[model samples]
Target: MELSEQVAIVTGGSRGIGRAVALRLARNGARVLVNYRRQVAEADKVVALIREFGGDAFAVAADVQDEYAVEAMAQACLERWGRIDLLVNNAGMSWDTPLFRMTDQHWHTVIETNLTSVFFCCRAVLGAMRARAYGRIVNVGSLAGLFGNVGQSNYAAAKAGLIGLTRSLARECALDGITVNVVAPAYIETDFVEPLPPLLRTWSIETNPMRRFGTAEEVAAAIAFFGSPAASYITGQVLAIDGGWVMP
Candidate 1:
């Protein structure tokens, strides 16, 4: 729990679950790099919030899907903090459409944004972590990936692929003293889902055993757990924070 000198990079840290995770890590004494794509102001707000809570954090701009950008993001963290102790691959996007109507552009965007970005970020820090013999990686996955959902084929596929990536990287990096894991959350009440149709919103809540939408902070707590030293022995595992929505 004592991550006083750790440095963490959290992609998509501008809002929602990402913002929550960034704050949680900062609260635990990690100097956090809050990564965002286009929302500089929002990302800055996250940094402000962390500072308000007596934490060290700053916002950085980068498109996670861009390999060079991701590498640069990681480098920035290293240059500023001297080492990267944790990474949260939480940048992602989703488009709803039936399989037949899912265009090539849509499919490619989702896969690249959600899955390939994770790989690029992981690769960017792998060598450094191996050299230091220390690191923690917590990927943000989705419940749709565990149980197929209507109109989200692309998102589900990307998240499912993330699970595979988490497992593979965990095994490959364990010997180097790094841990990799995934945290799947179901329908957290955030800006993303706040505008959804009432029917859909109601259904999402009713489907959960708790009969309520999860909070961003609730999801962040689980993610932070996986990145802590206490969870050093847990790797290649999927921890669901979905309120019994998906048992797996």
Candidate 2:
């Protein structure tokens, strides 16, 4: 019950790491708003699971890249819970293409989805968080942002931008009792990595000291820590949940 009576908004909460984070927060006693752009059914399933466990949660549809949609989503949270205590910017999309083959659309789509959406969602909740003098903001990033992965230039750039945003926002909100941090996971065992080519997947596992891809639940545990009061003194930091990969 670390987050008892708190309200959390988790983007991309329909599946993968986002879904795990939403469930974990709810398990800690937070009323959760599971946000998804598509996969309405998946989002509802997450909600159902939380409710079945006697936790409070509901699904809200929002394209996080759209400023208006993000605003409406924030409004919905406030209307239902009276305040927003945590915001997890976990909604992201990946486009894997070599730098030479990357088009403007490819670059923009990844940047907008992974980076711009964080801007929209963070700004949307800042007012309420500042007013309350308490907030926890955790942005989900990736190892590519830290160690530069081949064919993931757009993704790396977007996640790198997110790290910068996290640090700057942490400084700006420090006086307001709001903490901002990032969780960067590498090769997590989610649908996001299921399509990796055989050789690439082999390389992913062999290169890591742990010799395995991390699980969505493991990444969620790190996120849950950042979102909890236990981490109030921590901010402007990046924690890598990569099973010994990207050791920087």
In order of listing, the candidates' clash counts read 0, 0
Go through the candidates in order and give the C-alpha RMSD of each one to the true structure: 1.1, 0.6
Model 2 clashes, total count: 0
Predicted structure 2: lDDT: 0.96
lDDT tens per residue, model 2, 25-72: 999999999999999999999999999999999999999999999999
Best by lDDT: 2
Worst 10 residues of 2 by lDDT: 239-248
lDDT of 1 at 205: 82
Q: Which regions of candidate 2 fall more than 4 Å away from where they truly are?
A: none
Candidate 2: pairs in clash:
none
After superposition, candidate 1 runs with Cα above 4 Å error: none
